[model samples]
Target: MFLRKIANAIGGLLFLALFLTFLVQITARFGFNQPLPWSDELAVILYLWVILWACAFVVPEKEHVMFDLVWNSVSPTTRRLMRLVGHTLIGGLAIAAIPASWSYVHFMAREKTAVLGLSFEWVFLPFVLLLLSLAARSWHGLVQAMNNRDLDIHEANP
Candidate 1:
């Protein structure tokens, strides 16, 4: 819950920052007859962060898109099994991505953006975070599904 709130706040701020930066760039380019070279790069970075963080923010809430028509028609036991299988597969894929993503991030460690000179690794931090958040959410969903199954079983017995 707390992480979701934080992700929301951060995503909002990133979006605001990206929007304001674009506005500034436009104003500076046309209104002032001067263009800021760094603004475009900054906007790209901010946009990337906003997108990645927004994804993370939605994962915990299961607000991401899914085909629920078939899901809703399934039996309870079958639904639970499907959920566990889905979450497990997703979680495993996410786990698999971590090291490759980490290597990609590190490959740019010494590199910097053209205009801003910000470290490329820093620029790609949100990608890494997105993967991590996805994994966390997947595992969390798996656990929740298991617990629900246990509760359902207990209720049936009681």
Candidate 2:
């Protein structure tokens, strides 16, 4: 619950920042006829953070896009098997990519954004968080499958 609150707060704050930055950009460009150099870049950065953060923390698993035709048709035991296989593949791939993702993000530290001069490493760090979240969620799903806690297709969809 605490973590959920934190995630919601972060997601809200990022969106607010992005919206404010956009307003500032528009006001400066059209109202004052003097555009700020950093506003666009800042907006882009905030947009990226907002999207990736939502994907990683804010969005519920059931809300994600899924092709559930087969899933809906399968029996509970078959669904469990599917969940196990799917989560295992997803979690395994995410875990495998973490090291390389970390290396690339670390290497980007030397590069900075054009206007903000903020390290690229900081900008791209959310990607690592996303990968970690994916793996964690997959693990959770795997565990649920093992425990025979599969959600009905109707429940998941509706």
Candidate 3:
């Protein structure tokens, strides 16, 4: 529980910082006549981090998009079975994606962003985190499906 709290706190801080920086950039660009060159890329990358981290942070809350009307109408057993299939497919995709994204990031490391001179890894790191988080979340969903009793698709608090 404590660890979950810490993760939540860090996620919140990261999101807050991302938005604050974007606001600052917008203000500088419009409120004043001067705009920082790195603001656009930095804001986009920061938004990526928020979305990636939010995957782990949000799924436990059952907040991701779902076809709830359809899901609710299905028989419980069928729902569980479908859940396993869906989660398995998603997890497998996540596992497969890590290597390909990593390779692209590595290949681009020699080049720098036009504005920030940032390594491509800076952009790709969020994708790695996103995929890993999906893998973890989907695995948890699979475990719950296998249990086949009182299943909750939320990721474990850990």
List the global CA lDDT of all models: 0.81, 0.92, 0.78
Where does model 3 exceed 4 Å of error?
A: 58-61, 150-158
In model 2, which runs have C-alpha deviations exceeding 4 angstroms? 153-158
Note each model's CA RMSD in angstroms.
Answer: 4.9, 1.7, 2.9
Candidate 1 accuracy as lDDT: 0.81
Off by over 4 Å in 1: 149-158
TM-score computed on alpha carbons, candidate 1? 0.84
Cα lDDT tens digits, model 2, 65-140, are: 8999999788888888998999999899999999999999999999999989999999999999999999999999
- Summarize candidate 1's per-residue lDDT along 39-156 as a digit string, tens digits: 9899989988888878866443444566777776778888789878987998899899999999999999999999989999999988888888778878877887888744232234
Question: How far off is residue 24 in model 2, in Å?
Answer: 0.5
Candidate 2 at residue 12, lDDT? 100
